[model samples]
Target: MHATKGTPDATRFLELLRLSVSLVLIIFAQITITGFVGFFVVFLPFLSSSYSPGSLLTGMKFLIAGFAFALPWLGYWWMMYSLSGNGRIRGFFLLLLTSYLALIFICMQIDPVYNPEAMIPGSARESTFLVCMAMSAVILFPFYSLGVYIFVLRPVKRPRKRYRFLLLCLLFAVAGLVLLPFLWHSAPIVYPGLLSFPE
Candidate 1:
């Protein structure tokens, strides 16, 4: 019996797998922390009332839902970040956009009680989801771009012409708005019943 040596491709694959697992763990931690804070904020008023138990349970449900809804985009951002190399400004911007989108989707899905209609296939629900996604992209793009410009790009290299950068950002904003509807239609909803709790 002899041990077989791993090929370069296999070794690279294993390295990627390890990196992915680590990234996932980090993302989960972030989501858990965020969820806990959100739950506390939303459920604080119910603490002194008879509805405390129910509120606590609902808050827990929201926490779980938030984690589920955020996982996909978080993973997407992590992968993008890992591949970004020196051009981290673009990557960070992408991360911000995805995070904002995740928050928007989670907020839209929240209810005192679970709604099964969100998961059911119907034209109305689909349209609503599409609209929400597009609206979120539209709302977040400018903020995301500005944050990138201020925090990421400005420190690295000052632009010779600030107006040109602003113009570019505006162009990107317009492009994002134009493409959002198509993206909304094409993108599959990752966690349709994310707000639901188990029976």
Candidate 2:
């Protein structure tokens, strides 16, 4: 049998999953916005044509990134634990780090198959983007409930009112997965920019 929801093991496991997904999103969003230095993306733009930073700048970048990324996450957890009136447990942060690294390794090992060229008729970039999105919609179908639990229900301060407003989120997430194949043909129409990118 599964551990009850409020039990130590259950709570810890839920937090681990939430932290893993949130951190993965954070790392990727930072990469999208800043393109380097990973997580907080605090690295300075290249001062030399070689597209690299000096040693001092590199060190400074890492220092800033570490604090920038760590502070907010720590603050959120601090607030959470404080609200729950629980003593801080330090080891899970290390475990979270290990989980994030494992996720990175797993993602790197995935060789994405691209098949949108015929349907979307766009640059490799957009097609690849769409393919990844479609795959996510399909593969994550089962875990949408887990996502809702992590992102929505668990965060609610009121236990009784949790999931009241989030039923649609779960439905839409599942619907996308179910409809992706039928929707693939009209993707170009749906995403006007899909055809705008130069091949």
Candidate 3:
């Protein structure tokens, strides 16, 4: 009954949640879900018998989290862009590599990567999570494909009446700008660096 109360948390092959009418809602798959996924992946590796607020505050872990968080949105956009026939496969690698490099550059500006500890050992919950991930992906493949195609891929492919490439540039620029603040806020929290955040 509780599961039936709210909306499905994901539309792209991972219905991990049914969002309630609370402050935490499933609004932007490109941001919200992907970002959460990134944070969690980093976190799970770090979780162990001992936990402190500061356990997750290492540089390498933070970088991995950033990559994890950013990947989904980047993959969503890039994958769609690739299928759109707007450019060659070379362009896809160029964009992905460059953007990821840019992200690394920004992080380096704040603090360089440092792997200070070994990963926590496997736990009982790992199996549960694996099963859930596999099942959801298998079950939701069709919906994921359809959702991305209808909402993202089609519009991407439709740009440019005769090669002018009207608004595609602006669309990407906006997406980049929107991603910056998330990366920014997350940096200080995850890495606990130059920026001083409130308590």
In model 2, which runs have C-alpha deviations exceeding 4 angstroms? 1-54, 88-199
Off by over 4 Å in 3: 1-27, 38-42, 47-57, 88-199
Evaluated against the true structure, the overall lDDT of model 1 is 0.44
Backbone clashes in model 2: 0
Per-structure clash totals for the candidates: 0, 0, 0
The RMSD (Cα, Å) of candidate 2 is 18.5
User: Lowest lDDT 10-mer window, candidate 1?
Assistant: 46-55
Ranking by lDDT: 1, 2, 3
Residues 135-194, model 2: lDDT tens digits: 333344234423433544346465442353245344553454454444444545544444
TM-score pick, better of 2 and 3: 2
Which residue segments of model 1 deviate by more than 4 Å? Answer: 1-11, 43-109, 113-150, 158-199
Which candidate number has the best TM-score?
1
User: Candidate 2: what lDDT?
Assistant: 0.42
Which candidate gets the maximum lDDT versus the true structure? 1
Using all chains and alpha carbons, the TM-scores for the candidates as numbered come to 0.31, 0.28, 0.26
Ranking by TM-score: 1, 2, 3
Residue-wise C-alpha lDDT for candidate 1, range 25-143, written one tens digit per residue: 54454455446545443345533322111244433333333333333433444455456566453434444544555545545554333445667432433333333333444364445
